[model samples]
Target: MIPSTTASAAALELASAYQSPSLQSHSHRVFIWAAAYAREHDIAYDAELLFVAAMLHDIGLVPEFDNHTLSFEEAAGHIARVFATGAGWPAARRDRLAEVIVRHMWPEVDATTDPEGHLISRAAALDIAGKNPDDFTPAFRAEVLAKHPRLNLVEEFLTCFKSQATRKPTSSAARAINSNLDSRMLTNPLDAN
Candidate 1:
C-alpha cells in the first residue's frame, strides 16, 4: 500500500508542476473549499487525505488529453498508477485516492462506501459546478445548489466569492512558473534566428 505521507507528497508535487497560474490558484481554492465544507457539515473523513486528493485530483490537466469516453474506473486507475510511479507513491494509498478521483467524475456511482472518497468526489463536483471565475448569478447559484445539495455549495460559494476580494495569487509562485517557462523557451526558442 502507498504510504499516506507519500500520497501527500505526490499531491504537493502535482500542484507544484501545474503550468497555469490561474489553474493552480483555482486548485488551491477548491482544496480550501473542500476542507471547509467537510468541517462545516461535520463529515467524518481523513481531512488530510481528502484535501490532498482534492488538490491533486486534476493533475491530468497538464496533458489535456480527451478522455471523454473513458470510464471513471479507468481514469481513476490510471491516476493511481501515475501517482504511484511518477511521484514514488505507494500502491495502497494511491489506490485510495484513485478511487476518490475516479468516482468523483461520475457521481451516479455508489459513494457512501468510503468517507474520503465521498468527500473528495463531492468537493470536485462542487468545484466544477461553481467554476464561474467572473460571475455567479442566480442561475449559477441555483444550479450549484441543486447539483451539490450536500455541502450547501452554492451558499458556501457565495461566502467564498465575497471573501475572494481579500485573496491574491502568490507572486513567488508566479515568478517560479515564469522562470521555468523562460528557461524552456531559451532552450527551444521557436523564434530564434
Candidate 2:
C-alpha cells in the first residue's frame, strides 16, 4: 500500500489541475492566512499537512460544476474514498478529517472550538466570500457588497487576500510552521467541520 503522505501528495497534485488559476492563488493565500491565525492562537497543527490540505480543500470544484461551488459534504465524500484507497489514511483519521471537511461550510459547521478545523473552515469561508481581485467581477462584487453590508471584515480580508495573492510565501513564516508541532491546540474529531 502506498504511504499516507504519498497518497495525499498524489491527490493534491491531481487536484491542482481542476482549480482555476485565480482560485488556486486564492487558495494559497487562504491557507497562509489560516496558518497565521493558527500561529497567533498557538494551535498545534501539522503545518505541512494543513498547508497541503488547505490548498486542496476545494478540489471538488470541478469545471463541470456550474457556478463551481462545491458543497463541503460532496468535497469530503469525494476525498474520503480517494484518501482511503490511494493514501491509506487510517480509518479513524479518515473518518475524522472527512467529517471536518464535509462540515467546513458556513451555517453547517463551526470551527471556533478546534484550531485546525477553524483554520480550514475560515480559510474556505474567506475564499467563498470572494474578496480577491480575480474573484470580484463587477456585477458579483456589487451584489455581494449589497447582500452583505455588515460583513465588512470579510470584505477587508478579501482585500488582503487580493493584495497578497501575488506575493510569494514568507520564508520565515513557512519555516516557523514547519518546525513547530507542539501548539497543543484543541481538535474536535466529531465536529462536522
Candidate 3:
C-alpha cells in the first residue's frame, strides 16, 4: 500500500543506500504498520508524506547521516526536509514531513493535530518497543514478518541507541536509555513470540 510517487521512490532509494539491511527492513515495517493502523482506525492521513517520513525516520542513525550534535531524529528531520525540497515539495509540506519524522520520537502525538505523526509514533513504538503487539493480529504480524524479516534489528538498534546516548547525552536516545529502552527491546514479546 505504499504511495508510489517520485518522492517516495527517492526516499526508498536513499533508505536502501544509507541504512543497513535490518534498518531498511525496519523502515519498511514502520510504513506498513502505520498504514495498517490508519486504515483500521479510519484515520485520514497523507499517505505520501507518511511513506516518505517512515522511510527516513531513523536515517540519522546511519553513520552517513548521523549528526554529532543533533539527536538522530532531529538529524533525520533535516535530511528529509532537504530531500523533500529536492523533490519539489513546497515549504509547508516539506516542513510537515520533517515535523512528522521528528515527532515520531516524542512520547505522544495528537492525531487531531497531526495524524501522520501520531500514526508513525504509535507504529514505531509497536514495532521497536512492542508497546502494542495486540494492535495487529498474530496472522497479520506473521505475514509482515515473513515479508520483511527482523534480521538483527534488536541488537543493532540497542547498540545504535547506546552509542547515540553516549555521544549526545541530552538527546531523545538518551532519554530512552534512561527509561530502560534496552530492557524493553530485549524483553519485547514481539521478538519472543
Please give the RMSD to the true structure for each candidate, in Å.
16.0, 16.4, 0.7
Residue-by-residue lDDT tens digits, candidate 1, 1-193: 1125765666666666752444454455455555555566666666556756665665543434213444323443476567656666577866876777665555443434776766665655445443222233355444434432333323332333223222322322233233443343333211121
lDDT of 2: 0.46
lDDT (Cα atoms) of all candidates against the true structure: 0.48, 0.46, 0.94
lDDT, candidate 1, at 125 = 45
Clashing residue pairs in all predictions, respectively, total: 5, 0, 0
Instruction: Identify the runs in model 3 with alpha carbons over 4 angstroms from their true place.
Output: none
Candidate with maximal TM-score: 3
TM-scores, all candidates, are 0.52, 0.53, 0.98
Arrange candidates, best lDDT first.
3, 1, 2
Better of 1 and 3 by lDDT: 3
